[model samples]
Target: MERHCVFVTIFVLILHLVQAQNQTGFISVDCGLSPPESPYNAPQTGLTYTSDTGLINTGKTGRIAKDFEPFVDKPALTMRYFPDGIRNCYNLNVTRDTNYLIKATFVYGNYDGLNVDPNFDLYLGPNLWTTICLVKTGISIPFINVLELRPLKKNVYATQSGSLKYLFRMYVSNSSRRIRSVKMGQNHGSTQLNSTHEP
Candidate 1:
């Protein structure tokens, strides 16, 4: 009986240790920014983008833009990449021995909310990216909160240590509603995700 208890305790301890190694970090926006003009002008469309009013460059520069502040209740914000979904992107620097827990959130006034894969397509270095374990979204008073598209986790081996440059982005097929705010959690480099700071 004592031996059995000892084995059980050892197993539990190992499990806890492993869990501790995978703590997540948060990614939020500090400023909201917009591109001076439609970034897609290359396609030769007449669509023009205002510095803070439109979605051409939806970053910290946009959120803090004079016109964009009302919808931007929080300094940390998110942008919905529509027409060309998953096209809304941001760069993050990571380290080797750590994995990232990436979560994407969206909001709506009244939306069907479809077409968000919420996966890391581009990795700065060797990635520990994998498995969409969770996907969930719901409504709050002012807007519907769509979050946890996937509780995805990645593993970085010992050899994979140091700075990693990456892009975390997503898209939506239909334009039901666009809530431009999301929070990201990380195991390392939380400061890099600070949106308003600038590159």
Candidate 2:
């Protein structure tokens, strides 16, 4: 019994260590999840996501329509919609001059039952980042599904002035199997690329 207890304790400690390693320098938010339902690990990415509850004071939580839920990942099935304010912002604390990658994802699965698309602007602090214009189908307000921040290496994608906005990312490789991992830098993160080509 003593040996078994020692083994169990070691297992628990290792699990906690792994979880902490995965979350280092990463902040993931599931926009519309309720407080009790948050801090869940996404099955697709194995990333822990918390509710965007205390990040902002405005916006209301909502789930996508049942018909569209099956087509999206768990993070995209729910969203936070902002209908009252001209602009809604989420406050995050970061170290000064540290490079970071911010990612926001939106999936308009007709959450409001209006069947209409939404149009809005996204901003990074006081600067305009981009305008989100969903394809016209019906009519509704702006919504967001997931938001994430990952700290990057100091020299990766550095610019003299002003922040950088993500436009698109593409990976090219000649490997037949899916590109398992692409190392960003010496101690930076890695990305997985999927491909379906005869090679």
The residue-by-residue lDDT of candidate 1 on 96-147, one tens digit each, is 4444544434433122243232322221111233221121121211111211
Model 1 local distance difference test score: 0.31
lDDT of each: 0.31, 0.66
Candidate 2 on 100-188: residue-level lDDT in tens?
Answer: 78777877777877764354444554322221221122234667899888888888888865456444535433334353333222111
Residue 167 in model 1: lDDT: 49
Q: Which 10 consecutive residues of model 2 have the lowest summed lDDT?
A: 186-195
RMSD of 1: 17.8
